[model samples]
Target: MSTGAFSDTGLFVCFEGGEGGGKSTQSRLLQQWLEADGHEVVLTFEPGDTEVGKRIRQIVLSPETGELSNRTEVLLYAADKAEHVDTVVLPALRAGRVVITDRYVDSALAYQGAGRTEAVAEVEAVNRWATRDLRPHLTVVLDLAPQAGLGRFEERDRIEGESLEFHQRVREAFLAMAAADPDHYLVVDARGSIEEIHAVIRARVAAMLVTA
Candidate 1:
């Protein structure tokens, strides 16, 4: 059995993928749709939602900062997750609020772990420790080819500016994870119409609602 923990009181949904995968749009759509369905939803994102996380975001995403040690980047992300879960995610989930996050530990595992060539086990261990091993109830992977996704972004961040091979690795990592955990993951083709994608996500999430 999987050792990761989940909320008994509230749903925890996460959106993950490569760059330009429309995580923000889909997460917002889910949040709005759930709220219309009468859920108290908290929409947030990783590495930048909390105040401390904002600074970490700059360090990790800023192109001017250039190259950073892979381990340092992992630890920085871990710190943000620590603060985000402790102050934001856990409190809301405890009060029976559905939490929709644009990204989470999986992003760290895909980006820092696979993209940067860091050992996946070591990276996962750090992130699990940071978030106290809390796993999302559902992770929607917006699947898209790295080349196609990267082409959508006009301005590339530090991570986005990586070579195509790096992004290909990241894409493979996300798909591989979803394949390994079919019960908890939904792999949505990101090229579909926005409404079509949102409807698919809504249907899955609606089925998971116990009292809604």
Candidate 2:
């Protein structure tokens, strides 16, 4: 399978996993580390990074919205991806800034595709087009049991409140994708100490920087 398009001007890294897998923490740490090294870095997230995406994120993540059609959810997420790429991601990357995203196309494929039991191929196609086929140079998957991850959160979003089985499927989806593309992925045991996990991620990113 194709790895999709990667930027030639800048580095693109993404963090992926089930809910509460410390994607935010790791993404922040990576951004800080990159900035400290004198690299211009842009930290962003999907479904709400742009003005238009914020509304889409509210409708998709808010419990008050109740259930939506599985296909509807995919398109909403895709719309956010479209807006985000056009308004934020592409701009930074073209400017040679490191772009670290909390989640990207993989999240939609795992959560809306596998978690919701939607057609994975269809989800991938929509997202590929949504982001203009932009792919991260490296994706860090924080491997963790769904139970452990869910317990980390006191409050739940709509997606977070999903059943254990649902999250299990999502977790599997991330692993399967990573396994298929080892060169573009790093799977981390999220149960490790925060600093340890960050060290592992930084080491991998460090190597990529030598080439970047």
Candidate 3:
């Protein structure tokens, strides 16, 4: 049981992974477990649930949006993020609630950052201004092979409508992010059964909560 001493400020947790890596499932599981333990929890996503976020969500997820230029997509994502941070995340943190975001700037750095071949420095610059460097206390990256993950998504006919090659690039980008920041990030195997995977995640978050 976590004693719940994270910070006077809210603790932000984000999960990143390619499609079918179980990010959504694990995020919900973590939130439920935390709340069950008597903690305040706010679960949100990038291209969030807000009005602007929903609009951008359609653009990003729609295959018909066509080949959006890298910089253009990144800028749109950043714009959504700025509003998301200001209106949702920051307030939750200020109120000392645990904010569990489905994705964050790292996703931008990995997807648009890598897929677009946007210079890391440029990506970082945009993200800094957008998020004001509001780093997450913990970021969980579910690691799985690009082909396997993509296959799962395709099998479900829910590829997030991304092409196979695009998903591959996104996977590589996430791995790079994990290498650069190992301490705050945990790269977990996503090949296991959902229960097994969530078990590792639960243990990891619970430990953080206890020591937080």
Candidate 4:
């Protein structure tokens, strides 16, 4: 479908998942696939592409800090998101590019909103204000067992080092979000081979474009 036919310049799609889930890999594949199909594409990630974002990313992801309070952590993530939306996502959408984010507002919703400290409603409320009600056209959630996902995260450096219970909360939060918004979200089993997962994502994107 030519974006020229639609009133909007481009589409917004987000890939969301817990640590160890194949979000990064799948996000890359989707961006490549979209570009191959002739759509202009912008690939961005949370902890984002801005200078403030980079500083915030180092602070949040570093385990060197003894213990970060839940609300503080939540607010930090939200701050990063607000800057990211202002500087990255909104512009790409306005310019008619398919914007693929490795993580988005939903990550804060899951990891910090419902899972870590703040109330889900409060987290979402702040996000709504920050984004000015902007949302993804499709959110592909990579679902896997929390333990399985965290296991994959252990080798990497970062907050995936959090307690198992904390990660479980993250998974539960993601599931709840998907359950509540079946129309805009699709849950994909991410326990499979990379190729298989990418194939599923490609099919979904194709169908969504057709229907759009």
Candidate 5:
């Protein structure tokens, strides 16, 4: 539950959901709100936050990369996490900056476990090692039906092009993870208006800041 060095420093918040779940928008809104409230905020994302990550992101998401084995896909994702935590996340948290990310380990656990048919526990173990067991103080899940969420995207990435059944499984995986750890996760209905969702996120984060 604790990642040693980051245990007592700045808060780490992550937004997680399937594709087109509005994680990017909500993450940006949270970052803006935190900064306006006089908090030092670092906004970043997985699979593309660093030079190495950029390449990994391309390899993982590019349709041209073609059919990667489940093991290869998960390892690439873990590699990105290892570099991301060491460079972007840890440094920001150590500096007492509120670190908000678009996605995190949960993405791998959900996507690979469900979509790629990998074992959830195995994927989680890999990610835990990659991230040195660092976890978000708060994980906001923008929950939406897979069909509804995918409809929002005009073009699909390699992962996004998965079957409806695959996406449904991923959604369930996220919900199950959040249900198991209610205190650390806020599961929001992505069907709501953007402002409504942001208001709820702001309120939850505000409460967290007060306690922090």
Candidate 6:
């Protein structure tokens, strides 16, 4: 496992958690704030960032694709990440842009590892290699219970349609990963108001900016 620093001139921040945790909302908010502060920001997401990734995303998320094997699903996600980093993420980071992602490798670790009952360590290894060992400067996990989070979604995707037990495992996996790396993670309770969550996120990123 390669746990090292990312680009010195650029910041790669990833938002992670179970479904309907408001990761997209927070990622966009952070991007807007960074841009307003005169920083070049790239807002992106995994499993659908690039042209190839779009097709991969459709296959992975569509319920019609039905009953994929665990290994096959993991490979599809890894493929998306490989193409995403090569085309969208790495270039933006190289250009000294603040890359704010809605989801990253951690999603794979939590969803595939825990939800599918696979080895978490192996999942992490695959994702790390898929992303070329790129580590986010900060990973913000919007922690919420599976029942409440899933209830917020009117329509569920293939993964979201999973059993509540699966989602609970996924949530625990995310929390465990965050707990293992506190310095690199900000675990926020998602029950808070949108503005309240953004405020805490802003404070953390502000502290990083001062030191960066």
Reference-based TM-score, model 6: 0.97
Q: Give the C-alpha miss distance for residue 17 in model 5, angstroms.
A: 0.8
The runs of at least 3 residues in candidate 3 whose Cα sits more than 4 Å from the true structure, single-residue gaps closed, are: 1-8, 154-163
lDDT tens digits, residue span 5-66, model 5: 23479899999998788999999998888888899999999889999999999999998998
Q: What is the C-alpha local distance difference test score of each model?
A: 0.93, 0.94, 0.81, 0.81, 0.90, 0.92
Residues 111-135 of candidate 4 have per-residue lDDT tens digits of: 7776676787787777666666678
The regions of model 5 sitting more than 4 angstroms off are: 1-6
Clashes of each: 0, 0, 1, 0, 0, 0
Model 3 global lDDT (CA atoms, 0 to 1): 0.81
What tens digits encode model 6's per-residue C-alpha lDDT throughout 28-119?
Answer: 99988998999999999988989999999999999999999999999999999999988888899999999999889989988999889998
Which of candidates 5 and 6 reaches a greater TM-score? 6
Candidate 1 Cα misplacement greater than 4 A, ranges: 210-212
The reply for model 6, stretches above 4 Å from the true place, is none
lDDT of 3 by residue, 76-173 (tens): 88999999988999899999899999989888887777766678678867976898678888889998887777666433322356666777888888
Candidate 4: Cα lDDT at 65: 64
Give residue 80's lDDT in candidate 6 (0 to 100).
96
Better of 1 and 2 by lDDT: 2
Clashing pairs in 3: 5-212
* CA displacement after TM-score superposition, residue 134 of candidate 3 (Å): 0.5
